[model samples]
Target: MQTFDQVIQSNIALIQKVVDFDAKNDQLLPLDFTAANTELTDEILDDTDLFSDWVNEKLAKNNASYGIGGYNEHRTIYSRSTHFDTEEEPRRLHLGIDIWGPAGTPIYNFYDATVQSFAFNDNLGDYGATIILTYDIDGFKFNALYGHLSLASLNGLEEGKFIPAATKIAELGAKEENGSWPPHLHFQLIKDMGGLKGDYPGVCKFSEREKYLANCPDPDLILKVTFS
Candidate 1:
């Protein structure tokens, strides 16, 4: 049997666009949140408005429609919330690709799926409103998580509902609702949910990086979004 990532790689053409990747008007700009990025000070990270302004400024400077990155990144921004804190280590390794964009931006399914679960993970620095959809490809099953969404997106969702490829599923939430952070869609793919529902660890401690990363592969295999 081929691995989950391998199956996705083989069927890449079938994975639909979650964003308007081919739009002539939209541009993608890469953003960095690693410890090495000295620009993001505690003062800015602590304030959602300031952090959002910082993100938008970057996009504006580049004349881009969205700010993107953060797959397997050791982000310093998590320090702003205790939600990621543990006794042994803080969860700094990002397990998903973050697409920074305006609130209410529509998110689409990349594959035909059944709605597995949905929830409002309202914790600070959390996923906010989240949705998980199950997919099967070449007899291999997996789940894709759409996080930091507007609560309104969950208004009419039903578990087991069939959502077609490229169907609009959710919209990005505002800073006040989206984990109190800047607006962004946290997209992750999980080979195994480990019995979680609606929410999964989008970040992990450095100590268990390999374990979590194995279960959650790079979303770009399907997204195919390149930052140039």
Candidate 2:
């Protein structure tokens, strides 16, 4: 069987760029989450609300619609826990691409799929409202995890539900509902769920990078967004 990366690469063109992101024209702004980005702003990163405000400001000032990129990025923000194991290496390697935009932004499925499962993680620094969509392409089954969506996104969602390609499955959640962070969509491609549900590790320990990367490949293969 081909790896998820192999399959995605072979089907690259078929995978649509879900978010309105184009780094070439500055439609997207790359964020350096390793620090508070205090080089340009004096805002503090410890405060999730204020930090999110700053993120939105960057997009607005740059005239960009979204803040994109961060696959396999070693982010310091994961220290918040709901997604990390602080007791260990602090899992700072971000495994997905985040599309930071206004709350209520629509989230779509890249390919036709079924709702394998969904839930509200809700823990601080967690996925908050989450959804997992499963796909079976030629017997190669995989899933996509969408995190930090509006609580209402789950209103009528049901297990085994069929969602057509590019269907608006959920809406971006505000900090109040999206795990207390700025409004954004955490989109991750998973070859294996690790027996997880609604939530999976969006970040991993440095030592486990190889294993995790093998299972959680780059989401951009589907989003097709150009990163700066």
Candidate 3:
């Protein structure tokens, strides 16, 4: 059986920043929009549509990429808010590892793989532009998904394109190109999603945690980060 340990190593400098950010800002700090400007707070509450639009516009203006780590229950790493479809679900159970940085950050192919699928899931709450790559590792076949990417990455890209490990497959997109929030890369690994294509559930109900978790393991296994 192939393990992620046999795969790629992470960038140490980037990992340090993630660790440092959590330490300095209190990983459990509430997503306090109240601390922000009145205008911004009103926009977030009163006009979600306009607020989302503004976020998208800002992403286009500033090219950003992120390397934010995903949720860590033991460490108290949590999402600023909950948007799960159900109350029975884990409030902040993360479905993927977030590399939070800025848009346009170069995303490398973890290993030699062929593009299996790609799509522009443009919805209010969805992955803006996503790509899925499949490959073999130590005799085990697996898939790597790159979500919230720049639209340009999808242009001229087609299924079956051979992507070598560490190849710059795409750039982290601005909030607009990405589902509009912060610039970050949503990296996920899937064992099997059944017949699902062009769309996969990145978040799930806590009641179904075990099943979803077994299907999606910690991406840090491949990222090579020492989670605290």
Q: Find the candidate with the highest TM-score and give its number.
A: 1
lDDT of each: 0.90, 0.81, 0.60
Query: Candidate 3: minimum summed lDDT over ten consecutive residues — where?
Result: 11-20
Kindly give the stretch of ten consecutive residues in candidate 1 with the minimal lDDT sum.
Answer: 219-228
Model 3 residue runs over 4 Å out of place are 1-67, 71-83, 86-92
Candidate 3 residue lDDT tens string, 1-228: 435544433222322121122344322211212223244554364343565454445434443222334532221222323333454544445577766554676778766788888999876446789998887765566676888889998887788888776677788887677765566677788878576766677766656678877888777766544244
What digit string (tens of lDDT, one per residue) describes model 2 on residues 196-217? Answer: 8777888888999999999987
Which candidate comes out best when scored by lDDT?
A: 1
Q: Model 2: runs farther than 4 Å from truth? A: 20-26, 35-43, 80-83
Query: Which residue pairs show backbone clashes in model 1?
Result: none
TM-score of each: 0.96, 0.89, 0.68
Q: Give the per-residue lDDT digits (tens) of candidate 1, residues 140-163.
A: 999999999999999888999999
Ten contiguous residues minimizing lDDT sum, candidate 2: 36-45
- What's the candidate order when arranged by decreasing TM-score? 1, 2, 3
Off by over 4 Å in 1: 23-25
